[model samples]
Target: MLVDSHCHLDHLDLSDYQNSLDRLLDTARQRGVTQFLSVGVDLPSSSRLVELAQTRDDMLVSVGVHPLQRESPPLPEVTELLSLGSQPGVVAIGETGLDNYYDKDNAEWQEQSFISHLQAGAQLRKPVIVHTREARAQTMAILRDYASTSSGGVIHCFTENWDMAKAAMDLNFMISFSGIITFRNASALREVVKKVPLENMLVETDAPWLAPVPYRGKQNEPKYVVEVAKAVAEIKGVGWQQVAEVTTANFQRLFLP
Candidate 1:
């Protein structure tokens, strides 16, 4: 019943699965990872994910452009986001937010896009999936301004401090941890994990990247989310089964509600 709350299924390198997505998902299912949220980084990717989710009851999706996609011109409008975000199986509004670490020069553009997604989420009554890095202040400010309490969301792959985590939770956002939490140098992140309640937490792999320990050098998949859960459990001083149950419940409460 574990869920990979975030991942890019379409971007996975399926060579080890006989180049078959179904085979890859079956392997994940066999590992107890029965549900997935295949996040979209752009309109084309979003459309493909919606199509992919239509055939599988266990799959859901989020639609929006990534802030690091500086090459994708024109930025997204609220109308554009609403049009696509309203589609079936699209449970959330973004993988969107500020990413000043990679492209600080385009802060204005990213902020505009982020706000549009937030607006769309509010209007559609769907949650937003936020991706934030090195722009915590601006990210939290924009979220505080534009995010509606009724359209609560999750901060996917969170690597920020306890302050930001608490801030996001105060804004009705769950803090999702990825495989990065298992890294040897993530001791600080582990401390953050200890403080975040299981009620406000979710787990993910962000697969095709950031695989957990023992699988760190290998291509990541939804199946490896178990390792992320194991890390959270150890940090929280709880059982992995408890982590799985609580995170799955949190995921359903946020995305499927």
Candidate 2:
């Protein structure tokens, strides 16, 4: 079965009616995604992830702040994150990192918070779900500073050039392509995905956000990760099964710790 390495299943407006998680999970499972990584962007959401994970063995979780949170920088102690990390399905330490694209004014805060999460991940020995946007050099520097060579993480929603991809890989980080890889204008990113080693590659939807081609401009969800897998397979000239197995194994090794 495939694994969705990152998805914001809790946010994204799953309000009163139609598209319930039951249906979404069933669709994903039917499409070969049996496991999921539900990422938490803040305290309330992190608590929700813990609660969500408690209900299912297949659901794993990551806890941290989105770089833009005005919530005093999510400086939760290592002990607190470790306490949560010790729980049954808490697998990773972030949806955290630099987001210079979104919150330019808070760049300093973002840098500081990113370091804190990296340290927590280092101490807890959990793979961090790193998010870098328009700040590749800074992101790499901080990661290299705080993260040991052994404690690598995933570059989630990777849309950068192969040079950036190579740099992340050099630090032992995996590059995860999200649904954006399927877009027509994402040709450059598709090329990057092709050059990346399958052994250090993964796929995600960054769901509740960048849905793939046919589904772009709408709400995204985890199940669409298969479409990303399909795009990556075509780019890499590999079979869909190979993408499934390799990325799933990458997920297990990194997030499962």
Best by TM-score: 1
Clash count, candidate 2: 1
Q: Which whole-number lDDT from 0 to 100 does residue 138 have in model 1?
A: 95
lDDT score at residue 165, model 2, on the 0-100 scale:
91
Candidate 1 clashes between residue pairs 3 or more apart in a chain or in different chains:
none
lDDT of the structure predicted as candidate 2 = 0.84
- Residues 129-202 of candidate 2: C-alpha lDDT, one tens digit per residue: 89999998999889878975687899999988899899889988999989988888888988898899888998
What is the RMSD, in Å, between candidate 2 and the native fold over all Cα?
Answer: 1.7
In angstroms, the error of model 2 at 123 is: 0.7
lDDT of all predictions, in order shown? 0.93, 0.84
lDDT at position 59, candidate 2: 85
True lDDT of residue 51, candidate 1:
90
Looking at model 2, report the run of 10 residues with the lowest lDDT sum: 11-20
- Candidate 1 lDDT tens digits, 92-178: 999999998889999999999999999999999999999999999999999999998877999999999999999999999999999
